[model samples]
Target: MIRTLAFLVLLAGPAMAQDPAEAAQTAAARLDSAATMLAEARSGEARVDALTETVRAYEDGLSALRQGLRQAAIRQRQIELDFDARSGEVSRLLGVLSTLSAAPTPLLMLHPSGATGTARSGMILSDVTPALQAEAEELRARLEELALLQSLQENAAETLEEGLAGAQEARAALSEAIGERTDLPRRFVEDRVSMAALVASSDTLQGFASGLAMTVAADGEAPPPDASAFRGELPLPVDGTILRRYGETDAAGIERPGWVLATRPRALVTAPAAATIRYTGPLLDYGNVVIVEPAPDTLFVFAGLSETYGRAGEVVPQGAPLGLMGGETGEVQAILSESAEGVDAPRSETLYVEVREGQDTADPASWFSAEMRSTQ
Candidate 1:
């Protein structure tokens, strides 16, 4: 029975020694795919679309990597705790095995009882041996897994650095493409003088929006596309968590009629629907803002961007890049540490979304899809 147990242990050891870096490997594969996309974007005819996809790929790959690292850290901690809890039992088991291995075959076969008693001892050994072997195999597997998690963390630094660089490049390319883009339809020519005067006169977002609603399009210009069909189905313009719901008071104890989203640094912001850019620039207390008229008498206001894109009066398609959120991306070490600590990616920027119909503000939550909000 002892010999059989030892043989089983040997067999299980080799099989259980397989790498436990499956999560890390999957994340690395995603990063590699993103790199391939980046290469294709360089020469793609539709640079804007290509670069946009590339950026999303990088974001997904990095998110996967962070999650994998977090899981690994958790698994490693669990294994360590298990080992600590069973250290005494493991030591005693090892000592017993060592003594048995050193004993002569004749002595090992001899029991302190007669033949009938020896048979009973053999019966007990038969049941206990398999359980001991299984325990040994589990311990070995956990040890191997712990080692692998450490190795993955050490090697992931380079992969993360490269992914971050590629994402930055993709974003820069997308920005340049949008700036050079002239194919989008025009609804009107923005009167800079009028816009400037409105900005100077308006002290609140509602006031500004109301002023914008009164601006007329140039004669013969096309009307803004109808986005009413997309009501209750439009996706949020950016990937993020809803930090503050409509009418929720912020840290400053002031309430707003909009949804504030918390997003990662430099995350992409896109148009939720096909719309004409009514305004795109800094406004009072809001950073860079983009106000798009998605339908007649309806406007979607996006505020708090680091950099805005598209000229006012240009009609852009849905999912068109609007701007980027502010703040610098975290370094590899900081990201790894945060992952190891099992925390979410830092959302260092905020985007405020407001829906205005004529002069009254409507809840953005009603306009955006419920599923989209839950997922984000």
Candidate 2:
């Protein structure tokens, strides 16, 4: 009876019998095996219900593991600081002994007599004749070292205390949070919980805010810049064949209005008319492109090129090579003109004149001079 009682006491444990992580892992594996016992059953109520509960339990266990891990880290840091404080004290005590021996000054020792004897008044002396002096020197050196060590210990103790307090505060907060989360739906478990999720939520909110800022907001239709003040008609930016006709059909076979296609294959693309470059870079879907401004309220687009020669607001002359044709997938797009207010109308680069329905996209066939179209 005594043996059984003792066995029960041992099993109950003063140490609380915490499972080694490995043992907990093994238990998890066992539960996983149980959960999969009837995975083949398509509509068994018992199997489906058991599997769902198992999944929820697994997720809960994962969240608990993460919390436990953070607590473990706090404990480890506390232990490390405690060990370092003890070791530092020991080192300082040892260093004090070394410092006292290095000097022969007797006045600094607590017992000057011991220090005096270690160093004889005689001009020449053997090492053993000055035992008192050595003792006093050793003691003083040890005390000095101890003093520094105490300073360090004092600072370290304060720092350690602060760290521990902060850690405890954080741990308490997490403990309260965990307790509160017990009522949280299973959706709160696993990757759905913790700092990473908070960070992700913050990032998502930031992006949403940015997108909201980008959305156009206004009271009415947009205003158009005055185009009638322009001095003369602008020349076409490129000298190339119209690989695809304007507004008739697109490369995707979709009928789009007010855009023209010209493919030079590998021909040089240049600025048309004397104009300031609006943008000298690739455009979405159009590949490498250049946008130039020849007059107030008018934009010239030269797209599908391998190179660009100017920057925004830099003046470009007509026939100046902006870049070589990119002509990727055998299609090149150029706009002789465009309006800042249009939905899809393009600025032209293929003709001197274009047909527009009071919009930027114009009929290239009407705008192209008969003489220019033959070669362009």
lDDT of the candidates, in the order given: 0.75, 0.37
- Output the worst ten-in-a-row residue range by lDDT, candidate 1: 1-10
lDDT of 1 by residue, 1-376 (tens): 1122122222222222223233234434544554566566654335676567666656655665666666666766777887899899989877766786798877755678878777787788788778877877877777776777677677667777877887798788888888787666788877778888899898998899888745544632666698898798998888888889989999999999999999889988988888998899999998899999899989999999999989888887787788999999999999989977878688889999999998899999778973562212
- Per-residue alpha-carbon lDDT of model 2 for 126-148, expressed as tens digits? 44336645655655554554344
Q: What is the lDDT of candidate 1?
A: 0.75
Which 10 successive residues of model 2 have the least lDDT summed?
A: 331-340
Provide the TM-score for each candidate, comma-separated: 0.85, 0.29
Model 1: per-residue Cα lDDT at residue 116: 79
Q: Highest lDDT among the candidates is held by which one?
A: 1
**The best candidate in terms of TM-score:** 1
